[model samples]
Target chain A: MKTTRRTTILLALVLLALPLAAFAASPSDAGTRWLHVRVVDRSDDGESVRVNLPLDLIASILPEIDIEPHIKDGRVTLAPEQGVQLGDLRAVWAQLRQAADGEYVRVEAGDGNVVVRKAGTLLEIDVQDGPEGAEKVRVRAPLAVLDALFSAPEGEIDLAAAITALAEAGIEDLVQVEDGESSVRIWIDDRPEAP
Target chain B: MPRPRVTLAAVLVATLLLTAGGVVVLAAAEVWRAGTFVLSVRDEGPNGARVAVVVPGIVATLAAVAIPFMLPDEAAARIRPAAPAMRALASELAGLPDAVYVAVEAPGERVLIASRGGVLVIEVDDGPDHVRLAIPLHAARRVLRSVAFAAQRTR
Candidate 1:
């Protein structure tokens, strides 16, 4: 009778533990999945705008700002913690101000790409992938347009400082700044991975 | 001569009533649900919009009430064949009390399956080469999460 009771208890324990085990195993057992996003400039004008980024990279970076991200079927979904919206925006703006030293403009992200455009009345911004792997950013807007937008009282807008701040925020790496007569373009290449 | 103010007021009121009646008749012919979201689609143009609203649970209950009365006869016939399959699918989704309600629309014959939680998955009938997606409740939650994020960011 003791042995029968012991066997029944063991069976019940095993049944109880089964669900817990399954729950723990699901996420990792799903294996490695890749999410790719591509953006094309479908405008008639020769406005060169192209961006590519992996969704997993964004998912990993979201936690720094206290956002829980979930990716399913190539869509990156994020749920911000309650009351973190305004706080996050303020913190982000403050960080940008400090980094730019009053040379900050507008930053936008859409279709899985972060775009920093010429801060002008007209909408002019360069589209590029977020800092992950070897990605490149090409800004086709002219310097005059950008300069006109950046009407600073004291000094000119420092692109290097702005780019560095963006990189630190896990946005992108500014590799080379190309200056042209018509357009001053900056190429943001992905930073080399650490071993 | 005295101004015909009373006659004008009567004419205006009659016109307004006729317009309201016409709108009601047209609305009855279409599929509309006021739940966590408001979804209204016209049968003629197949043009529709879904907008999220506050008090989704109450809205969903109200939608449940209005669905039967509003569903046109043609839509009712089209929905009959897909009803069983939709019920089975809704039952498969956890946390849903009732089987998914199927609403059909003419002009290419579209099918909208809505759960008790105001989650809708639409299917379009395109001859033999057709595709239908059954989005789970979790997927709907994910969508809502994204919208919430957007709202936060905008704020």
Candidate 2:
């Protein structure tokens, strides 16, 4: 009985110490996640191309960010904002074709806004900040976009050429074309698209 | 004998678990600035036989964190594949041909691209903002021959 009791006490002590031991054993954040983006292709009209993004993968790309979900057919649907819209796609492309350095474009969709930097690929879209009735939750695109863009045939089409093309496609005034290497942005006003 | 084997296996498992835990703690210490350090000294017998032990347990831990910044990177020209799976999927998503690219070890990821044309096989290991691409085996052979020729000329 005494031996059993001693063994029981020892086991209990070990159980209690398990967490501390484990804590002492491992470090935190051994693995890390990073944001990625890529381009798929040029649209049929050389306008905007469809991008493939997985919601979970996209969500993991950004650290310390929250995204909202929507209810559809009694199921949850995550909405990720793709910066492209009809009007910005039209005007930005034309201006981009002739835009000099230090120019930017701004695009507004409903209450949401997206800014494009000159000659850069990333479209910084703002989903928050809207009126009480506006749908301004939060969203992010997938890192797969980066994967595709970087892997594409980078032979003749340099990063600047791609950003210029995106601008000339009427992306928006808020959208800026940025320098590929220098990371300088060109800002523009958000203009209303023609109906 | 059976009990001894079981005990040995348990000890081995315990050692492995401890090693893995130590690795994780070290990695966490890198990103979060949190870690536990232990130092001990022991003296035994009449003359005081001394011993010292440090907790980090691995020499590589210090070097892995330090070397990246200290050395200058030599810019060598090379063409390499980057993000084969993402590239394949993006191509398919953008109306390119559908292909399958396997993740090899990470089966949990649902997205993959593969092709069977036997013309060019590409593999992409994707990371945040960076990717590693591997060329097809046939291409590797051709590249190897060219590298051999270059080495011969240098020699």
Candidate 3:
């Protein structure tokens, strides 16, 4: 009787603690995150494609794949062909990070207009080009992700850290592009698939 | 066939009526339960092509059960990684309030994507063609969940 009672009590405690432990681990918006990329091509042959990848898998595999001199050691090194200097990028990023949350750059030209600003937790960028500025592109990412990109030394971008930030932030619609043909959206969430 | 039994014929008639009544009741119940599913589409077009689709919530939920069997091994493996994200998207959309997620108006074309009262709607009007789709967010989530489930079983 004692053994049976003891076993029953232990089982009950375990059952009770399971939910509490789970809640504590992921109280609200915290858990394994999945990155989602959706493209809807609405042209002559309309097609919708969805790609979902877990941040953990991406973080693990990114270092394994090498793209010559440009990407190595889970970090991205700029090539001479790219023309943009790492020092300039780092300087701009540092300035943007410290600056107050507001529109920093706004250019309205005859061809197009570009807007780049820091809003809340996101670095928002919008670019309009083409005829009458019809083609539009928007990119939004958490500050943490940007910080991770510059985490490495010698002006190399640390992709692993950036992925970790993307996983933790649970961001949605990190990048969106709209044109006459189709619209593309990429986001990160806790879900593995898209509907 | 042995005696041309009247009882058998009577039973057949009674069974048909009972089944028919049961189907009607179930359909009504489904319509009522389809809160996240059914929504009116206020779309304007020159052609005025209208279509009514009564997709029960259960149908979307049931797709989860069918995923494993319907998907091939290779496809299921590919989908396994994305199942969780599908569930997350579904959950977020289901809870989101009325808002326009995307709206683009171009020459001779207009596209609107919005969520209203837990229902996700997509509308596109191009030239004389107009298409609108409204789905309860929960149903979409359920369908996505099934995809996740199928992905797991494949592994």
Which number leads on TM-score? 3
* Residue A57, model 3, lDDT: 56
Question: What would the TM-scores of all predictions be?
Answer: 0.22, 0.18, 0.47
Off by over 4 Å in 2: A1-54, A62-195, B1-63, B71-155
TM-score result, candidate 3:
0.47
Better of 2 and 3 by lDDT: 3
Cα lDDT computed for each candidate against the true fold: 0.36, 0.32, 0.70
Candidate closer to the true structure by DockQ (higher is better), 1 or 2? 2
Candidate 3 lDDT tens digits, B1-155 = 32223434554565556556666776775555455444434335554656556666677767756866898888887776555555555445444445555565556677777766557788787766767788877667667777767777734
lDDT by residue (B76-137, candidate 2, tens digit) is: 11211112222232222222122332323222212223423222223333222112222232
Enumerate the candidates' DockQ scores in order. 0.01, 0.01, 0.02
Candidates ranked by TM-score: 3, 1, 2
- Each candidate's B-chain TM-score, in sequence, is 0.30, 0.23, 0.63
Better candidate by TM-score, 2 or 3: 3
Ranking by DockQ: 3, 2, 1
The CA lDDT at B88 in model 3 is 52
Q: Look at candidate 2 and tell me the lDDT of residue B110.
A: 22
Task: List iRMS (one decimal) for every candidate.
Answer: 29.7, 16.8, 17.3
lDDT digits (tens) for residues B43-147 of candidate 1? 233453333323443444444445555556666565543443333333333333223233433344445454433344544443332334434353343333333
Please provide, for model 1 over A158-194, each residue's C-alpha lDDT reduced to its tens digit, 9 standing for 90 to 100. Answer: 2323222333333222232222212222333332111
Poorest 10 consecutive residues of model 3 chain A by lDDT?
A: A21-30
